[model samples]
Target chain A: MPENMTHVPYYPGCTLKSKALGYERSAMDCARSLGFEMHEIEKWNCCGASFPLTKDNLMGLTAPTNILIETEQHCKERDIDAKLITLCSFCYNTLKRTDFAFREEPGKLKTLNEFLNREYKGNVTVIHYLEYLRDVIGFDNLSKMVKTDLSHLRVAPYYGCLLLKPQKELGLDDPEEPVILHDFLDALGCQVIDFPGQVDCCGAYLIMRNPDKVLELSHNILEEASEYGAQTIVTACPLCQSNLDQSEAVRGEMPILYFTQLLAVALGLETEQHQFESHCIDPKSLISSCKKFKEFSDAK
Target chain B: MQINTENNQAAIRDLEIATGETISDCYQCGKCTAGCPASMDPSPSLLIHLLKLGLFTKAVNSASIWDCMACLTCSERCPKNVSPAAIIEGLKRIHLNNMEPEINLNSLGQEFLAHSTQQAVVSGFRKFV
Candidate 1:
């Protein structure tokens, strides 16, 4: 490892360790290829999964606050910038919003710190991997690092809801019209398809209580992407990927991929890192076809 | 509509203090309802209207609050910056605080629990349970 390699704290939340292992694997590989290292934070807990909606419900804020304090400590130990990166959009939203809450109200921060018996100076910056790629690595530079020609693949970039919403808090992109995912696919040389349901919610936690509603909602996103001629749909949220991938309505019609998996493929990383078996819709056939097409063109 | 001025004032005060959002700021522009992806009956605007009219019980007990995905599109699109999503969430908090949680975790099928993502289960518990 280069001495100057940028080392940033990473929080994988719960899904990444279990259901979304591919997301973490591919993201780590991509970060390395892009000249950065994502060191997982020590003993990090879940970011409470959801931000507390009511002002009085400080209990929900505890888990994320503890994680933020841990990230700050990790940054100090590594002597790196006080920045924490997350691959899951849900974690990104919760952590960022929690940090925002603390910044907005010092009293809440003080209360949380006191409760946790830890100190967070409101110094750590929470960022999603997509934002790190765009702002830090620059898509132009990422374009230069692509090892495979993925232009044959027509891809739809799914933003989902948590990644960009409550604009005043997340502020990652225009919640109405986001371009980060589109720009990311462009950098990878894939033909990006702009679809209607790109930024819509995939029924999220409602999946547990109402799978039918999730299917209907996810089906709409898949149908729209397919209508626009997309071969695959890539998303940043594990829950979004799972909801869309497992929907009985569009089960095998669209291959739902984590954005980092596509990035790993384009970077020419090992195929095993993608962990395609976890995906409900097998993306292997689609990826292999693209690979064959690239070989033919290269041989010519 | 029986105008219960006393009940209305208390409900409005409780909501405002809990959510830090002014329900009266909503002007029924319908932008929030237009962008909502979930099947919010009485719609986002009408829910706020119910609250504004001091029909707190009607707003809280409506099945629409449970149907909300909390996508925040309604909150983002609100022209008055009322954050209807937060208000709806406040209603959910109130509902949960007052009543026994409608969705029991043990009652959920084992297959569903096994297949679902952790975030879904965690957030489901946070919101519904």
Candidate 2:
């Protein structure tokens, strides 16, 4: 609560509040460590989880638009910049794309605003927390803050689909060959691995309808990461984490973690903040092993 | 496989309106199919081809529509920017509007429901239901 500390409006979405508490907790803690406060938007609703694919589905745009309006008000009340940070990749994509849609079609914005009895000037810039780290806080500064040596752990940065698809809209990174996760992980002192399944789909929402196909897809991603000698896999999407973590075929073989959790660890935050137990495949042992090796080598 | 030009034209027009992508822009480059990880049969290119050939019914009937994960790899790889992924989603919207949801929430086992993330359940209902 220092006077000069930056205040960033945040949207936790549905998953972060319910299933992805670890992702939320770690991200907030890391933001504080990095000298920024993530202010949650009061009375924010769901970002609809998935962006409505149909061009005519303005009804689907309402949920995220409401969240954006709330973010704008949240920033206004605090006298901060109109930037809303999202943790969940799905929420990031939905809110970002919703903002993009309104920008593309001002008429649609007018229709939605009039219908909802609210005015959103499209002033809010929706960004993922990773973007904030890379853009706002340079990786150089982040590397300087790393208190733990994670060089012993080889991590795979999984982009999945939401973070980098439909490049025209999201444009977070190269949808084909992304390096933000690599750069972020590198700054954390971990060895980053480049794997094929990094940007591939982990069967996404298909898990609900076709769990078998999801298993096959998630298994393929895990196998590829394992083949690349990755000791752990880090992702930005809650659904991707769940699908990859719940792969019955390779359960407990590879621990799938949110990128923020690893950031919390590298920042030397309290263990409870990472919420390791919430993960389907607990990464506590893997993380502890890495720490133990660091200690053992230091002792040598 | 009788090709009904009328229905095909209507379907194509509907899809263009829904997705805002020109169907004729696709030239069957196969890059979308090659890059797809979902193992979609009657691949994305083939579905676009079917629409071009006035085989709207066949394209709509293909089970591959459901198999699409909406990863947007095909859409991103398309040289013509046809966004076959969006087209497939448009097809899904059309299909869903006409039929009952294929997934029954009650039929899902308790364990699966318990472990699935809220994002999955919400997005699952959005896409499947």
Candidate 3:
């Protein structure tokens, strides 16, 4: 396993390990197929999604700070400073903001390291898998490796906050008009459709406190996608998927899929390897439809 | 000045220092309110207006503070960079610190926990508690 020698340390946050199994499986498989290998850290913990905007709160910083310390140690053992890959957008956002706090603010970093009993600086860089794909793997190369062209599919790319917000440290693209997912989906041979609700908040976590708000937000997104002729909405955040994927209004409107799942399917991985079973709306119909298209195209 | 009014003034002063953003900087532009996705009753601008006037009671009483999704849309579009999202968070902290509302952890498990990630529950506790 030559890839193992240079394996990049991967952090699978709580959601990916439990609820988003397919996201993890498909992301790893797709990364491997693209010539990048992800090695999960032996010890990792959840990065609380909502980063405390309060400057005086040290307790809020503990969880993400400890995860960074562990990741630093993981990279040290491998003698590699490769970036830590995160599969979930919320995790990516939380970790990235915390990491920035450590690097930019010396006073906070000193106090956090002292509390954690580790002499760690901001050594390990945290990046979302989308960044890994776009920056590291190169979308053009990714496009060339497609086994089943997804040209017949129309996908709405939902960024659902976090990936680009606060505009201070975590902004990955033009917050008003991001095209990272647009180019990525197009490269995979899928027609990317433009929708206004693509960047709207999914009323994240409000599904608990305010279910109606979440339903309204999720329904708006699904309705917009359906109106635009999108078959499924692809997203990078597990929270966004959970909120939008299986709501009563969105259940049959359109299937919500992790971008990695789509990549794994396009890379010609067996259906069993991806966890389409966990999805509420059932993406198997969409996958089978693509398979039928592949078979029909191959026959000609 | 009445003792209660003095305390309210102190609270606003402390909040300004804590958030490192002066309410005076807001200038009643309403840009934050216009861009806010969660904008509704007691709009972001309205909350800021009350906060600038040192009306902590009215600001905290409004349910809109809790409704802020922390999407930062207002922050991104704010002409003065006045983060209504951060202000709302500060208001929640003040509420939690004052009211000492019993954040029944059990209440979190009602129905949403089943669908939510552990990260969300943990973060929600960290922010609210």
Candidate 4:
């Protein structure tokens, strides 16, 4: 994972391209440093999030299937070897899992293919940046590249629900506790907080369908993280980051951030890369709380 | 997940059916209600049960949803998936669509919406996607 690599497919979800633009910038920096190029999935659409269990089940799967087929075809059409990577948590789950399910479930894939053929057509392998870092790139190799150490601050690694629960179905991580986020944080030289509700749901989909549930779920997390002495919360996906940071009930009060925000700090990127002020939660104080560094040279 | 939710502060049948779910089968189980950590105040499970049962009309309109963290802890622990959390979510959806004009939007809500837009543009999952 060096600084110069060939181009690979990238899927920039809504937040990355806009609100989470900071994530996009850090990703670009990381991708380049890791010898990777992000080739965005042009003309991509939603991934059945916000409301996956729509009035029709097949209709729900169609959203993600379209992107998968497009990626699949692109791989075959151009005969390229690289796969698609996502910065969004929900998008990553939908894309990676859809490709996984379709590849493993022939019947479901066939049905999806019929719909895909009518719309988008391509071959693609979907994955979150965290997955590529751990499974393929290796954290040990990743840690070697870090010039800045975040070992002073303790971070509560929040997985939310999509990555964990209904474990037998999603296959994202262990139902009880998932440590991929912590592993990455630990590599960055940060202290990881072992909290009880790390993998719990942040009332993601339920937010739109039920705001009270979202509030209850959110405030609960902030209290727990604060109680556990986690100065800030780091996440790989944007939705959880946004939810943990933006919601009014939990916003302004708790310290939370995206995993990339922390990584950007590690890469020696400017503070703007983390966009602390613009965040709904106003993590400016938390960012400073990450362990005041007069300069990276001071640590040396 | 089941608990003695009876003889509580609120009655289940007194509220409106926001999520369109039936709470009579709830069996006084406080799983969903207990798992919720929305408010620092003691507006616990049984009250949420009553809220779901059409007891608390102002619950959805109030600042409760804004206080909820969207954690699905109760839903996972419920024996019958009584899903007071789900019911609360339904109420929140209704409240958001018709929230008070002076309401202060939380960072999490804004972030979730922005993130949802991104996911939608990427895969056509939610809006226009």
Q: How well does each candidate superpose onto the true structure, as a TM-score?
A: 0.95, 0.94, 0.93, 0.68
> Model 2, stretches more than 4 Å misplaced?
A1-3, A248-252, A292-300, B1-6
Off-target runs (Cα >4 Å) in candidate 3 are A1-6, A248-251, A292-300, B1-6, B99-104, B108-112
Indicate the worst ten consecutive residues by lDDT in candidate 1 chain A.
A291-300
Model 2 docking grade: medium
Better of 3 and 4 by DockQ: 3
Better of 2 and 4 by lDDT: 2
Real interface contacts reproduced by model 3, as a fraction: 0.51
lDDT of each: 0.86, 0.86, 0.79, 0.61
Report how far residue A64 has shifted in candidate 4, in Å.
Answer: 1.2
Q: How many backbone clashes does candidate 4 have?
A: 58
Second chain of candidate 3: TM-score?
0.82
Error of 1 at B101 (Å): 0.9
Model 2: per-residue lDDT, tens digit, A1-300? 346668888899888987888888889888888999988888888788889877888889999999989988888887888999998888999999999999999999999999999999899999999999999999999998887779889999999999987789988999989999999999999999999878988999998888889998889889889889999999999888888988933654778989999988887777686678977688888877655235534755
Output the chain A TM-score of model 2: 0.95
Q: Residue A171 error for model 4, in Å? A: 2.9
CAPRI-wise, candidate 1 is medium
Model 2 residue A145 distance off true place after TM-score fit, in angstroms: 0.6
Task: Count residue pairs with overlapping backbones in model 2.
Answer: 0
TM accuracy, model 1: 0.95
DockQ of each: 0.79, 0.77, 0.59, 0.14
Of the two candidates 2 and 3, the one with more favorable DockQ, higher being better, is 2
Model 1 spans > 4 angstroms off: A1-4, A248-251, A292-300, B1-6
* Local distance difference test, candidate 1: 0.86
The 10-residue segment with the lowest total lDDT in model 3 chain A: A291-300
